[model samples]
Target: MTVRIVTDSTCDLPRELVERYGIIVVPLTVIFGEEALLDGVDIDAEQFYRRLAASKVLPRTSQPSVEQFAAAYRQAFQAGADAVLSIHISSKLSGTLNAARIAAAEVAAEAGRQIELLDSKNVSLGLGAVVLAAAERAVTGADLASVLAVATATIDAVHVVCVVDTLEYLQRGGRIGRARSMLGTLLNVKPLIHVEDGEVAPFDRVRTRARALERLAEFVREHRGASRLFVACAGNDGETEAFIERVRPDLPGTEIIRGHIGPIVGVYTGPNTLGVCPVMPV
Candidate 1:
């Protein structure tokens, strides 16, 4: 059976890998003032950041509609995909999964094809790792059940920690969840946060960005045996490179993939956000 992998834009997988693996990415919407642009398509990281700095109003994000997902599923089936493992970001964070689930049910009932939905319970490269892993398995001709197993296992094993320059963007985006308490002294410290069980949680707090970077490297060091490692930045070219260099010693010979936190995730994390994500073995 030909199993295809489908993920939302929040997966944060690189463009090359997306094309190479035939991974389908459904985009979320980012609203800037009166403009509603698709995450990766209509608006890119650079443009979003420029507008964000100049505009007085904070941008808002919206999940994709069911129709959009349904169309994607139809296209996949038409392309001869026997089944689809429609993995997505955390349902707690957005209604994207609900839309996918609703679309899956409709496709199942109407077309009699299989569509299994998996929630990464993660964002950014945390989500990217899982999608890429599942896609690797699928490209090896794994059945839907096997591919779904790999996906869920990756979700359970993956770990992600991010340090945003400020918590205000998160507060404004309303994705703080259990991490809301970090807001009590937002101005006093830099927050070290992790996405746990689909909700943002405080991992630690450091008085300086320097200390935060150290803690991030230590976090990666603690998970050195992961299947892969990824470092993401929100347009901090120098910071991102320096961070990778600092963290590389901990990873030993492991090759860490470099990526950007794109406009979709950047809208909430803001710029200068750097994160470490590890994809551990199931």
Candidate 2:
């Protein structure tokens, strides 16, 4: 059976990667005031971030509708595919998974075909890693069940750490209202956060960006066990590059992919967000 892969925009995989793997991306909506734009299609990351920086009100994102996923599934099956595996962002972070589930049900009812929806339980590169693995396996003639098993194992092995420049984004997103209140009272406090089991949680707090980077590296060193690494930076290329340079010597065998954090994540992380995710064996 021919297996197809689907994923949401938050995966942060490059356009080339998506096309190369024949992966279908369903975009989440980004709302600014009364206007709604598709994440990567109607609005590119550059434009999104530009608008985000100019907007007086904070930007918000909504999950793709069930119809969107249903449409994609129909197209895939009509094109001679036998099955589909949709890997999505954490359901705890967004309703995308729920939307995918509803879409899968609708497709099954209409076409009498089953679509498997898998939640990565992580975002950005963490999600990207799983999707990439599944896509590669699918191309190599792996069955849907085997591909999904690989994706699930990769999901469990992934870990993410992010450093936000300001607490305003997190506070506005309601991720750290109470913690921000307490942390903000102190000067020069930069908090490091991690996504664990689909939810964001605080990892540590440091006095400066330098110290925050140090702590981030230390955290990765302690938790990462012989895994490929990916680094994401938002509006801080120099700092991110420097951080990678400092840590490269330590992780000798790990392959690192670097990307700028897109606007969907920028909306919540604000500018100057630096993050790292490692894909280890489960």
Candidate 3:
């Protein structure tokens, strides 16, 4: 059976990998005042960040509509996929997974094939790692059940931590979750956060950006045994590469993939956000 993988734009998987793996990405909407644009489709990271800095109004994000997801599922089936394994961002973080669930039910009968939906309980590269694992398994001709098993294992093993420039973006975006309490307390410091139990939680606070980056390296050192490491940021100020260099001494001969924080996640984390996603061996 041919099992295809589907994810949302929030996965932050590189475009080449998405194309190479035949992974389908459904986009969410990013709204600015009265105007709305599709994340990763109509707007990209650079443009979104530029507008974010210049515009007086904060941009808002919305989950994809049921019709959009239904169309994606139908297209996958039309392309001869025997079954589709749809992995999405945490349902707790975004309603994207719920929309996918509704879409799956709507299209399953017409496609006459199984459409399995998975809530990754993570976002960005944290979610991307799981999707990549499942896609790799599917490309090896694994059945839907086997691919699902790999995805489940990856979701359980993956860990994500990030340091944002400020907590205001997250607070205004309503994604602060457990990190809400740190709002006023983080005035002069950088906030360290992690995805815990499918929601954002406070990790630590650093006095400087230099120290926060160092702490991110410490996080990788703690998870040195991870099978895969992905480092992502919102800017091109050489921070991602510099971070890898800083951590190279601690983890010799380990492969680290560089990724960019896409528009949707960037919408909340704001610019200059740096994060590390480590997928431990399952």
Candidate 4:
């Protein structure tokens, strides 16, 4: 049976990779003031960041409606997919996976076919790695179950870490979650952070921004067996180069992809966020 892969925009997969792999992406909405723009579609990374810099208030993110998910699944079926392997960002981070699940159920019942759903427990390139892994399998003519197996394995092996320029964006956007307490105390210090169990948590604190980036590179180097790595920067600070320079020595033979944090994630991560995501083998 032919299989198709579906993921949301939060995966942060590069556009070329998404097109080459034929991965169907349903976007989340980013509400900037009165205008609600589709992530990566109506409002691109450049546009979002520009608006973000100008606006006094932070943008709000909303998950795609159930009907959006259902339509995507229907399209998969229409494309002659005998089965679908749908993956999404962590439910704890957003209600995306829950919407995928409900839509999968609705589509499954009506189509009388199985629509597999997975919770990636990751965001950004961390989630991108899993979707690409599954898509690779599906492209190779693997069945739905086999593709799903690859996805699950990739999720287990992947590790992600990021650095926030300031706590202002996360705090203002109200996505600080567990890092809330750190809000008042160390507002001056740069935060070295990671997403664990799908929510943002502080990994370390450094007196300077450079040190936080050093810690980020060290975190990537210490992962031991990562096969591929992704380095993403959100802001136009030209820090992506600096961050990649520190990370490249350790990443030697590992495949690396560079990304800019898009508008939706940037809403919470704020401007100038840098992240390194690695997917290792089991």
Candidate 5:
């Protein structure tokens, strides 16, 4: 049986990987004033961040409509997928997974086939890692149950930690969960954060960006058993490479996947958001 994978744009998997794996990516909408742009479809990371810097107001993000997800599932089925395993960002963070759930039920009922949905419980490269693991399994002729098992195992073992330039974007975007405690405390201090229990939580507070980078590197170093590590930076490639270099010496054999914070995730992370997502063995 052919099992296809579906994910939202917030997964932040590179285009080549998505195409190579034949994964379907449903996009969320980002509204800038009266104009709306589809994440990674109408606008890319460079354009989104450029507009973000010059705009006075923050852009608002909306989850994909139910029909949009339904269309994607139908597309997958039409392309000869016997079953589809849909993975998405944390439901607590965005309604994307809920949208996927609604769509899955509708499509499954109509097609009379199985459509499995999973909440990755993480975002950006964290979710990307989960999707990649499942897709990799699916490509090997694994059934839906086997692919689902791999996704579940990756979710359990994956860890995501990030350092944002400021808490303003997260606060304004209403994504700041337990990380709210780090707000209203400092001006120049970089906030270190992690996704825990499908919600954002504060990890630490650092006085300088350099210290924050060191902490992020420490995060990767500590996860020595991870099979795959993804490093992401929002709207900045230089910093992503620098962080990888900082941690490369420590992790000699682990596969490091490069990820960019896409427009949908960028709306909350803002610019210069750097993080590490490690998928340890389950």
Candidate 6:
């Protein structure tokens, strides 16, 4: 039986990797005022960031609808697939997982099929790493349960830390309050945040961007032990480059993949954001 893997757009895996592994991506909706655009389908990352900067109102995001998942599952089953392993962003952060669960149940009833859904309690590269690992295992003829085990193990081991240039976007997205944002602005403080069970939360705070970056490296060095690393940057090439250079000496043999944060994440993080995600051995 052929096993297919599916994930939502927030995974932030590169398009090439998604296509190469035949991983299906269901896009989330980004609403700016009265306008709604699909995360990556209707609007590209570059365009989304551009609009985000120019818009007078704060943008909001929503998970994909049940119909969307149903359609994707139906198409995969029609192609003679035996089972589907659908992974999604954290249920705590968004309703995407619930929508996927409902769609899977309905599709199973109608077609007498089976779809396994996994909630990756992590977003962006954290979620992407889990999905990619599962897809790789599936290609090697792993069964649904085995593939899910691989995904779950990876998801549990993953850790992400991000530093945003401005707290305005986070405040607008309800991640931080106006008072906290104001305090950070007044103190020129950089907030260090981490993804816990897929929800972004405050981990620590520092006075300077340099100190925040150092703390990020320290966090990874202390917790990662031996693991692969994924680095993401938003609207700041210089900072990202500097981070890579600084960390290279410390992590002698760790594999590293670098990329930019896409629209869904960029909307909340804004520009000049630097993030590091580590996938510990499972």
TM-scores, each model vs. reference:
0.97, 0.92, 0.98, 0.96, 0.98, 0.91
Better of 1 and 6 by TM-score: 1
What ranking emerges by lDDT with the best candidate at the front? 5, 3, 1, 4, 2, 6
User: What is the lDDT, from 0 to 100, of the residue 218 in candidate 4?
Assistant: 81
Which model, 5 or 6, shows the larger TM-score? Answer: 5
- The global Cα lDDT (0 to 1) of model 6 is 0.82
Clashing pairs in model 2, backbone N/Cα/C closer than 3 A: none
Q: Which residue pairs clash within candidate 6?
A: none
Residue 143 local lDDT, model 6 = 83
**Model 5 lDDT tens row, 24-80:** 999999999999999999999889999999999999999999999999999999999
lDDT of each: 0.88, 0.82, 0.91, 0.86, 0.91, 0.82
Please list the residue runs of candidate 2 whose C-alpha ends up more than 4 Å from where it truly belongs after superposition. 175-186, 223-225
Model 4 error, position 83 (Å): 0.9
For model 1, the superposed segments whose C-alpha errors exceed 4 Å read none
Q: TM-score ranking from best to worst?
A: 5, 3, 1, 4, 2, 6
Q: How does candidate 4 fare on TM-score?
A: 0.96
**Residue-wise C-alpha lDDT for candidate 3, range 96-133, written one tens digit per residue:** 99899999998998878999999999999899999999
Worst 10 residues of 3 by lDDT: 248-257
Q: Write the per-residue lDDT of candidate 1 for residues 1-282, one digit (tens) a residue.
A: 898888999988889999999998999999988889998899877788888888898899999999999988988898889999999989888889999999999987787889999888998988999999899999999899899988888888888899988988888898888888878886769899999998889999999999999898889989988768988888787988988887777776676888888888888899889988887778
Q: Which residue pairs of candidate 1 clash?
A: none
lDDT of 4: 0.86
Candidate 4 residue 200 C-alpha distance from true site, Å: 0.9
Output the TM-score of candidate 1: 0.97
